[model samples]
Target: MPKAILKLYLILKRERFDIVQYSTTNAVFYAATASWLACIPVRLYAQWGIRYVVFSGLVKIIFKQIERWCCRCSTVIEPDSMGNLEFSIREGLYPRDKGRVIWNGSACGINIERFDISQKDIWRTEYREKIGCDVHHLVVGFVGSIRADKGCNELIAACRSFFSNMPMARLLLIGDKVFYSTIDKDLRDWVESSDQVIHVPPNDQIPQYMACMDVFALPSYREGFGMVIIEAEAMGVSVVASNVPGPADAIRHEVTGLMVPVRDAVALAEALQVLLRDPAKRTAYGVAAAAFARDSFEQKKFLQYVLADKEQLIAEEEFQINHAGKHV
Candidate 1:
């Protein structure tokens, strides 16, 4: 670790970097420290998610402390979600003054061009048929890590309950399943045994799959920001997400999508059923959601916002450095 840090520090020193930024825990630790040691004026750390919150015992303690040190080394900590920024400040993991969220909360907003609503019908028909489902099937899609933290177990339980009512409802999970004990036993059994569940590996064709969804579900326990929620909306797919911080910002409850309490299987199931049963309401929500995404969440807007902030901060830092050097 020391050798890696020195190597990075030398690179920054040689390049005479005006700014340095890092995101992941490993990268943040190394990059932030190297940037700090190299006396870079703008040291930014992008907080994507809180890993320590998921662990326990010594592991949690170790990760939390490591994050704390990373925060200390950074001049600014930009969390993609306001909820995470609040938690980081509340826990003193990052200073309140240094933490900020750009726009509402998304690392990089969705590319609306990819999820072209003009070709929605074509993509929907194509992808649904490709996945062996037709217009008759009620598809509930989820696109994230198939792990405990993503609320996969809760989602599966909710779908199972919903299936008892609408047997035709299919759960299309479009991410790799993680082999961990944290995954529910019932979920495992159902996935292995039931034909209603379809597991697709992660691919570049996310927008295509997203267009076919009757509804999208994100029952995540934690998130820096639920960017997928916005992506689904861009595809004109209404969402039912956990009323957690990250997703809450992405959705307009009862308008763009429904928000269920975190880990509440019954609520999740009921919300899914409501949308599935009422095509009019679902279509209305989808229309409203797409407009919301189009108006608010474009990748270019996020890039502009962040780049403007970066420019301003870097200028301020350099001005201060020159001011101090004159005194020295």
Candidate 2:
């Protein structure tokens, strides 16, 4: 690790970088260490999420210490969500003043133009028919890795409950199941056995798949920020997400969509049932969610915020250099 840091420091020193940004835990530690050693003018650590939150024992302690060191070494810590920022501060991973959230809080916001509702009907027909599901059926969509921490078991349970009550309801699981080996065997068995459950491999046409759905579900145990929630919203789809930090930040309970307790299959099922049964309420929530997403999580607005931050940082660096020159 020391040798790697030394090599990185040499590169940074030679390059004379004005800004050094690191993402993920490993990159943050190594890059921040090198940047600090190289005396980079602007050191940034993007805290997308914390993986060690789910761990225990000495492992958790060691990871926490590493995160803290990275945070201390960086000039700025930008967490993708307010909830995550608060969590980091509470855990003493970083000081509150050093951190700031971008826009409403997503790594990159949704492209409202691409995920347009105008194409919803077209894509809905195309995908639904492909899956042999009629237009009247309520498709509860999920787009992400199929894994344990993502609440796949809870989602399957919720779907089972929902399907029992409403046979017209279908589950659309879209992602690379092959890569996510942590998926429960029961969930896999249910998907394979049930005709109503459609497990499509991950594809580029996420917007089309999202449009086919009347509602989206992301019952993740934890997230830095739930970008897909806003993406689904941008497509005029109501969401039922876990009441964890990331999803909570994106969803406004009862207004935009619904929020259930983390890993609570029964509560998730109830939320899905409510949306599926009440078409008027579902449409209202979807409309409000679309408006909220466009106003808050648009891609253009997100980029502007990021560019503005970079400009400010550059200005500060210039001011410091000028002051140092005057002092000399």
Candidate 3:
């Protein structure tokens, strides 16, 4: 890895590159090491979150050391949110002064104007009719990958419990399965046999489906600022999510949506029941959620912060290069 990085750095250096931007932890480590070896001083690292470190064992400790080394080599380390910045500080991975937060969590959010509910009535009707989720059935939806870490299993359990009480409610699941074979047989049977549960394949029509649902649900065990939460909110769908870091940061409890503990199927079911029974409350939450997402997680604000951070990192790197040149 070191040798290949050094070779690539020599090639890029000869090409006269002005700024170096690195994404992901492994790439940042290699880029920082290669830049130091090649005497190219302009280096910047972008972090979504420390996933490997938080997920793995001894490797996580090593990742922390590697991150510290990369942080020292790079001119700046840009994190996606204040929540991530706090995590880095608590983990002792990077100095607080070295980290910068880009606005609105995601690097780029969904195009809000394109997902307007007014333009989606036909699609909504088609979705409703196709899934047998008419006006009589209150639909609760889930979007994103079907993984245990994403709490898809918990969602299924919650839906089973929710449907037992509110038989008229429907579960709308959107996204491709991450490991279809690994899922429990009983759970698969339940999803297929249950008339109330409808599984949609991953498609470009996410916005249309989101608009059709009364409430959007995701009870993830881990997330580094989920873009889907903002997407659902922008489509005027009320959300019910796990009380984890990213979801908690995105959702305002009872105002925009309800939040339950991670992996609490009963709590998720109860929350679903609340939205299912009360049509007026659901609409109120949907309107409030849409307004909140537009004001907070819009794409324009995110782009502005990312661009500014990039420029500032470049300028600092240039200053370091000039200072080193004077000493030589």
**Pairs in steric clash, model 2:** none
Candidate 3, residues 100-195: lDDT per residue as tens digits? 767667647557777776656677788788777777778889888776777777788888865887778888989888675445677778988988
State the number of backbone clashes in model 3: 0
The digit string of per-residue lDDT tens for model 1 on 22-129 reads 998788889988999998879988888877887899999999999999999999889998888888888889678899998867989888888788888999999999
Residue 167 alpha-carbon offset, candidate 1, angstroms: 1.7
How many clashing residue pairs appear in each of the predictions shown? 0, 0, 0
Q: Model 1 scores what on Cα lDDT? A: 0.89
My TM-score estimates for the predictions, one after another, are 0.95, 0.96, 0.87
Q: Pick the candidate with the highest TM-score.
A: 2
**Could you tell me which 10 consecutive residues in candidate 2 have the lowest summed lDDT?**
178-187
